[model samples]
Target: NYCTPYLGYPYYSSHDEMIHNLYHNDDCMPMRGFYRWHIQDPICFDEDLKVTIQQIGVGYRGLFERQDDVASVAYWYQAEPHNRFPKLPDKEERWPR
Candidate 1:
């Protein structure tokens, strides 16, 4: 399970479950995604966790799933073992008013 399962918010604990729920079900998705660097960046609960990360997507039941402003992150598969990266801190560390 990846999601921490805190607060009243509901989340899939496993990667497969999360992906299945997000893509297979309309009731569960167009789910919101955010970064929590100060606390945690949504790490996987599994002991053999390697690439710890959370993924978010956009789209709703209609043509446009999300009706309001939302945040997102993108990852491009650049040539393996390359240096130089962009600076993107956790949602809180970057900006907050």
Candidate 2:
């Protein structure tokens, strides 16, 4: 079961479930995709913020950690007078393996 239960949002459930409710049924495609959370409910972070991802699975021996490759992109709106942005890596370095 690939569930995305994070923060206080239990309704997120699985990737397919969220995609089905947020977008048209036909809009969902397998594999490569992304999900936006601010659509249904918005979260306000006034202070520092941190994000983490975990992969767990169950088997005959019981629950255990699993290894997986994941990629993510985040978008946020900040107040005026923002700090200088950090330099980015070269195009070759930034490319996915």
Candidate 3:
């Protein structure tokens, strides 16, 4: 998705005033930002769905598998009559520390 970096531009521009640069060290080498492609590329699934991401990088040596710490969150929309989501405990009970 690098080719279509979602900067919230009018078209396909790289004007990044929408998203904050979470990590951008070494001349945009090890760059990382919160990317959203739901508008541009919406995926449609019928029944079940699974999401996965791979850390791949390209450098002077070319494309290679990368090992990086990654964190992600996913949200989905369902049709009507869907099963209700289980209720969660209070914040104090959920995050007892």
lDDT of 3: 0.62
Candidate 2 C-alpha error for residue 4, in Å: 15
C-alpha lDDT of residue 59 in model 3 = 84
lDDT of 2 by residue, 1-97 (tens): 2335333322322245455465664454333433455645766687666778887979899999977556777667878998898899999998866
lDDT of 2 at 68: 58
Judge candidate 1 at residue 34 and give its lDDT: 38
Q: Which stretches of candidate 3 lie over 4 Å from their true place?
A: 1-31, 86-97
Q: Compose the digit string of candidate 1's lDDT tens values, residues 4-64.
A: 5342334432233444556654553344443334233544352343443343445464343
- Tell me the deviation in Å of residue 12 in model 1: 17
Per-residue C-alpha lDDT of model 3 across residues 24-70, encoded as one tens digit per residue = 32233233555466866878888688876887989899999988656
* TM-score per model over all chains: 0.21, 0.45, 0.46
Which portions of model 2 show Cα errors greater than 4 Å? 1-36, 80-97
Candidate 1: misplaced stretches above 4 Å?
A: 1-67, 84-93
Better of 1 and 2 by TM-score: 2
Point out the worst 10-residue segment of candidate 3 by lDDT: 24-33
